[model samples]
Target: EAGVAQSPRYKIIEKRQSVAFWCNPISGHATLYWYQQILGQGPKLLIQFQNNGVVDDSQLPKDRFSAERLKGVDSTLKIQPAKLEDSAVYLCASSLEGGYGYTFGSGTRLTVV
Candidate 1:
């Protein structure tokens, strides 16, 4: 099975600037999730997608964050007008509905200046 893939690995942007991250989930997996991991806390689910449909996004900051899964294969997360507090590890993970451990990518580390 192909593992999740993310790009750039790291990014630095000024506060109020915009940044985006990409993700490619494992093949055959039906559930994909994006999480924001702050300095010390656990990963918080920002959004979830089951195929091309969004399953959950209650925790996502709608005012500045947006996400979409196109063709039900890959996804992107965008944050416009970034904030200093937004600096964190953006993790992408996938799991099968039946039951399986999630496979996480190395993650895109973002820093706000």
Candidate 2:
């Protein structure tokens, strides 16, 4: 089966700039998640969606971040007026069940320059 896919691999932007990342989950997978991983720290769940409906987005920084999954396939996350502290690896993952280990994309590593 194909794994989750993410784009850009890396990104560099100044504080307050806007950036966007894309993700494509495996076929047949019904759950998708976006996480922010800072260096040396664990991945923190930012948003989760079951199909095209939001399941959990409590951790997402709504002030500057937004995401959506249309048609229950590909998803996109966007950040506007990004902060220096927001620079981190944006990882996309999919799992059959929330209890199972997720398959992660290489991630979009964002660096605030």
Give a tens-digit lDDT track for model 2, residues 1-113: 88899998999999989999999998877899999999999999999999899999999989999999989989999999999999899999998876478889999999987
Would you list the clashing residue pairs of candidate 2? Answer: none
The C-alpha lDDT values of all candidates are: 0.93, 0.93
Please give, for residues 1-113, the per-residue lDDT of candidate 1 as tens digits.
67899976999999999999999999988889999999899999999999999999999999999999988988999999999999999999988872368889989999999
Looking at candidate 1, the ten consecutive residues that score lowest on lDDT are: 94-103
In candidate 2, stretches whose alpha carbon ends up further than 4 angstroms from where it belongs are none
For candidate 2, the C-alpha RMSD (Å) to the true structure equals 0.9
Backbone collision tally, model 2:
0
